[model samples]
Structure formats: structure tokens, C-alpha cells
Target: GLLRIDHVGIAVADLDEAIDFYERTFGMRCVHRETNDEQQVREAMLAVGPEGGVVQLLAPTGPGSAIAKFLDRSGPGVQQVAYTVRDVTAAAAALRERGLRLLYDEPRRGTGGSLINFVHPKDAGGVLIELVQPAGA
Candidate 1:
């Protein structure tokens, strides 16, 4: 089952610039940053408040990356919403059994060593949904 809100992802053209803007304007703290080669994204996780809300900033690694396509089609903006889950495999299986289409056949490596998978946007309204199983959780 889903545990809680993990992070809200936002697509950006410039990762460093967006990190600077969020930290400067919203006072959010950049808690983690990394690049996922397979996913073709460079991302940063920002802590929003004392309650532990997170906003993820995602930038494309190249022109052909998904983030780049998202930027071209929609401009920089909210890209996906994620939920933390105790067991991503189980959660994904449950969702699959319910007739939802998962983007990947198996969970893929996500931020901070976590396992993650996505539900097709077309299967869940127009919003991309990510299910995250936190590292060591």
C-alpha cells in the first residue's frame, strides 16, 4: 500500500538555476541531488518545511531525454506526483491487478537508491504517478 506523499516533481530547463530559485524564493533546502543515467535526468530533492514535504526538481540530461520533451511540450512545470510505499513491488502488483498500466515491467532505480516505478499518465488521469520504495525502508 502507499505510505505517504514522497515528492512532487517539477521539470526544469536548468537544474542549477531552478535549485537556486527554489532555495532563494521558497526557502526550501536542497536535501539530495543525483543523476540517473537510464532515466536520463539530473534531479534534486528539496525539503519544503519542518513536516518533511519534498519538491523534486528534474532536468533533462540531453535534448532527447524525457524531461527535455516535457519542457518542449509543456514548458517547465509540474511533471509528476509521487507516493512513498513500503513495498513498491507489492504496490505495483496491486495496481496492476486493478488494471492500471505500469510504465516499467519491473521497478527501476530511483533517487537515493530507492526502487521506483510509474503508472501511465493515461491510466491515471493526465498526471504521471510514481511509486517509491525508499532506500532501506
Candidate 2:
């Protein structure tokens, strides 16, 4: 079934500013940063606590990025919740069998070397759910 909470995505207008806020205000540390050109977003991950779960700071990198659109529509805020799974494809299949609405018909590449699928917000009670399986997991 579910493995663990993968990450909590916080949409931001400025990645560096957000990172600094988390670091200085919450004593978190940036652990990873990656730019996804395909998604047109730059993401910086900060470990939250002793458990080391991360808060992903996302900034739109291009004019047409989905994050940019989201910010335009919703402003900077929490975006989506990601959960780790043992097998993303299998998880998607199970959810489909249960008649849950999925954003992706099949698993697709996600950040941090994971296979990911999204459950539609309408089906998930207004919360966008992301199923992620780490590469080689």
C-alpha cells in the first residue's frame, strides 16, 4: 500500500526567498535543488525535522509553467501532497479498479527519480494526491 509521505509541496514566487525563510524561521536546511525544464520549475527541498521529511519549495522558471499558472490563479501556497508507494503502476491500477479518477492514465516521470501518478482533486475530496515510487524501490 502506502510507503511514506514523500514530500509536501509549497508553491512560491521566489525559490531563494522561500528557502531562506524556512532556514531562518524554521531552522530547516536545504538538502536538494533541481531544475525541471520540462515542468519549467526550479525546486529546492528542505528537511523539516528529525524524521527528515522535506518541504519542496517550487518556483516557476518559465512563462508557461504550470506552477506559474497556479500562482497566477491561486497565489503562492501549498500545492500538492506526495505519498511514496512501493509500486506506482500497481497503485494506479488499484485506484482505477476502485473507480477513482486519476489525472494520469498511467505513471509518468516525477521529480527525484520517481514514477508518479496523480489522483484528481475531485476524486480525492479536493486534495491533489500524488503517488510516487522511488527509482529501483
Candidate 3:
């Protein structure tokens, strides 16, 4: 079963620039930062408020990264929506059985130590859908 929204990912050309804008506009502070070399993206977590939702600032590290392509084609904007699920592998399998096109055949590591899989945009009404399973199973 799906739990809740994991977090919303925003693609940006410059991570620091985006961080400045968000902080000035929303008064949010950075809670964490890390680079996922496998995904070729650097991310910074910003707290929306106290117990508030988190905002992820993602910047492509190379031209081959998906975020790089997104920025090249559409500029900076909301990139993907991720939902927390109890079991990503099972959830993906079920979705696949229902005829959803998956970006990855299996779940992969995601930010905040979660397992994640992406449902193709073509199968998700043009919006990329991500299923996430939190750390420690």
C-alpha cells in the first residue's frame, strides 16, 4: 500500500541559485545535502516549515543526467512526484501487471535512503511517477 508523498523533486540548472531563491521566498533552511553519483545529481533538502514537508533541490552533475536533459528541454521546474509505498518492488510489479510502463525493471536507491522505481511518463499521463520505500525495509 502507498503511504504518503515522499517528497517533490525540482530540477534546476544551478542548485545554489535555486536554494537562494527558495530561502528568500519561503524562509526555508537547508536540512541536508548530498550527491548521488549514480544519478549524477546533487541534492539539498530544505525544510518547508516546522514538521513541514521537505523540498528537494536537484541539480544535474553532467549532461547525461536526466535532470540535465530536462533543464535543456524545458528549463527549471517541478520534475517528478514521488510517493512513499510500503513495498516498491511489489507495488511496481502490480503496476506493471496493470500495464504500466516502468522506467526501471527494479527499484534503485533514492535520496533519503529509500528504494525507488519510476513509472514511465507515457504510462502516467505525462507526469513521471515515483514509488519509494523508506530505509530499513
TM-score of each: 0.97, 0.93, 0.95
lDDT of 3 by residue, 17-54 (tens): 98999999999998888899888999998889888788
Pitting candidate 1 against candidate 2, the one with the higher TM-score is: 1
Best by lDDT: 1
Q: Comparing candidate 2 with candidate 3, which one achieves the higher TM-score?
A: 3
The local distance difference test score of each candidate is: 0.95, 0.89, 0.89
Task: Give a tens-digit lDDT track for model 2, residues 1-137.
Answer: 88899998888999999999999999999998999887689999899887889888999998799789889989999888999999998998999889998878777777877788888878888777889999888
TM-score of 1: 0.97
User: After TM-score superposition, what is the CA distance of residue 3 in candidate 3 from its true location, in Å?
Assistant: 0.9
**Number of clashing pairs per prediction, in order:** 0, 0, 0
* Local distance difference test, candidate 3: 0.89
Residue-level lDDT tens digits of model 1 in 66-95: 899999999999999999999999999999
How good is model 3 by TM-score? Answer: 0.95
Q: Which residue ranges in model 2 land beyond 4 Å of their true spot? A: none
Error of 2 at 59 (Å): 1.1
Ranking by lDDT: 1, 3, 2
What lDDT is reached at residue 124 by model 3? 89
Which stretches in model 1 have alpha-carbon errors above 4 Å? none
